[model samples]
Target: MRILQQMNAFCVMTLIAFSISASVQAESPAPVQAAKKALAVGQTAKDFQLLSVGGELSGEVKLSDVNADGKVVVVVLRGFPGKQCPACSAQVGDFVKNASKFAAKNAKVLLVYPGPKSQLDQRADEFLQGTKLPAPLTFLLDPGYTFTNAYGLRWDAPRETAYPTTLVLDESGKIQFVKISETHRGRSSAAEVLEAL
Candidate 1:
């Protein structure tokens, strides 16, 4: 009878251990799909279509279509990582400050905002409250990091969205210039992108 009791206790302990392991696994966050390599210059850029926050694209924008006529400056912003990013605003201001230059070069700018699907639009609207996007610039929304993951720019860290990437693509969709910042600062400037064009 003691051996039988010991066997039953062993079975109960095994079940408890299994249950704990399963619970821990369930609570752990899923692994993020890390980029094999950052998108480099001279490589062809992947085309994507995402909802537009404000642009001449009629509430939707496609990369290829935007770059069809001229070169495109793709800016990936850290969208609502709990609050508005001042660096992003400054970078955007730099781009907007040079709007005329980009237009003169026939280069259209597409700002990519990446964040959660819930309240993304509202957050984007808040981000653009005071600033105005000129005709040469468009705001694209990246819900659930779809565009961010596809482009291999997902930060996937605590209080992070994208890696603050900037890529200038030619009319043929070939990347001419690419700058990816691992941190909040070191964003691409308007003059640099204009020179790339």
Candidate 2:
């Protein structure tokens, strides 16, 4: 009888151990390396259509449509991350300040604002309250990190959003230049982007 009881207890313990392991696996997300490969310079850029929550281009913006027009595209922005990011503001400001220069090169700049799906539009609108986007430079919404994940730029950390990413795509949707900042401090400057163009 004692041996029988010991066997049952061992079975229970094994079940408990399996349950704990399963719970841990369920709670942990896949490592960043497991994500889709990020786009590289010279690769054909993936086309995405995200909503224009705010800015000069306030509607659905399609990347393919822009590429078809023989225009270069510059996409780089840290989407809303529970609040306005100062670095993002500065990066976007630089682009907005150079909007005329981008237009002169027939380039369209798309600044992506990514965040959770809940209240995303409201947050995007709030983020744009004080800024003005000129022609050929627009703000886009990446609700629930859809675009961020698709582009392999989701930061996926506590209080973090997408990685600060800059891509310059040629008229054929090929990436002419790309910069994926490992940290918030290395964002590509407007001048560098123009030079890439």
Candidate 3:
């Protein structure tokens, strides 16, 4: 009976091992994802003018002022009509819930919404409707996706939209941290981003 148990365990181990090896062999090899062109750590973040419900977006918020005063958290959002983007809405809600935590860390948050200029105003307002954003958080719009192109966060899929990403820029406007998602599922959380800071 003892030998039978040992054989069973050995067979289980061997099966797992063979299954893993076969899976690896049968899988189509994936090419290495090219290093995407975007702001890297220690690189200076560029500036641009954005269309906003509040008027005067983009270059208005300087990275230097942010770094010299406190930290800057820039969250990018995919525009409206791009699958409802429940993930993005949830992400912003979560961050707004923890807005104070970011303030305690001396960071100002800017949410960047990118869409075509014609629809930017309406779409941006839809995202900010009735949401009590703390004073520290500013919602900015990228009309015509100039900022997306400049920041290298444009997603070129047929039915896709801009890349939903997060960037932490220092006082001098240099990127202290950056996170860009290829898929639509991920945009950094407030806790996750604060920890990065």
Candidate 4:
């Protein structure tokens, strides 16, 4: 009877551990098939200027400004809360960890979140809090998806969200690397973008 009880205790502990691991892995949920159509390498990224949450001044920032003196990593995020998007947040967090690495390689990181202009500033501010993305990172609002439409990241699938993708631009503002998620889950990691640089 003593041996049986010990085995039961061990099984319970094992189950608890597995449960915790799964929760940690869910920091970002992956996107489905429709968000995938990524751009090709060597493509010249279109220039875009967006209004930021820092306060409304229309077109205050240009894509060229972010990628100007170094390489730039453009991250597309699910705009607002139709539902909480764990995957988009996760991908941004992954790149946040490597902000310095990109800096060391003379690169910039741009985090773009698109949604309707209504409540966009509030939503973007909340999303950016505690992300640890410093000066080199530019957080932009694609209000009305002005930038999203230009980039072709609009996912019109039934009940689907925006395209979750990543682009690496060289110093001259030309795309050197591109990662279009086949589903929302498959974003390019910090290591992958670094390797391309």
lDDT of 4: 0.73
Q: Candidate 2 residues 1-197, lDDT tens each?
A: 99999999999999999999999766524433333244766788778888875565778988898678766655556666666788888888888889899988988888888888988878777778866678888788888888887777788888788778788888888888877776677889899999999
Among all candidates shown, the one with the greatest TM-score? 1
Query: Please, what is the TM-score per model?
Result: 0.80, 0.78, 0.75, 0.73
Selected candidate, larger TM-score, 1 vs 3: 1
Report the CA-based lDDT of candidate 2 relative to the real structure: 0.78
What is the TM-score ranking, best to worst? 1, 2, 3, 4
List candidate 4 stretches off by more than 4 Å: 1-38, 54-59, 130-132
Cα error, candidate 4, residue 2 (Å):
69
User: By the TM-score metric, which is better: model 3 or model 4?
Assistant: 3
Residue 20, candidate 4: how far off, in angstroms?
A: 41
lDDT (Cα atoms) of all candidates against the true structure: 0.86, 0.78, 0.73, 0.73
Error of 4 at 23 (Å): 34
Tens digits of per-residue lDDT, candidate 1, 1-197, equal: 99999999999999999999999866523322233244677789998999887854557788888888989999999999999999998998898888889989988999999999999989999999956688798889999999998887888889999889899998899988988776798889998888889
Q: Which of the predicted structures, 2 or 4, would earn the higher lDDT when compared with the native?
A: 2
**Model 4 agreement with the true structure over 1-197: per-residue lDDT tens digits:** 99999999999999999999988775433332222333567778889988654321234778777666778788888776475577877877777677678778877777788887788887787777745455556678888878877787766565454677788888887778887764667778889988988
- Which residue segments of model 1 deviate by more than 4 Å? 1-38
Order the candidates by lDDT, highest first.
1, 2, 3, 4
Pairs that collide in candidate 2 are 79-113, 79-114
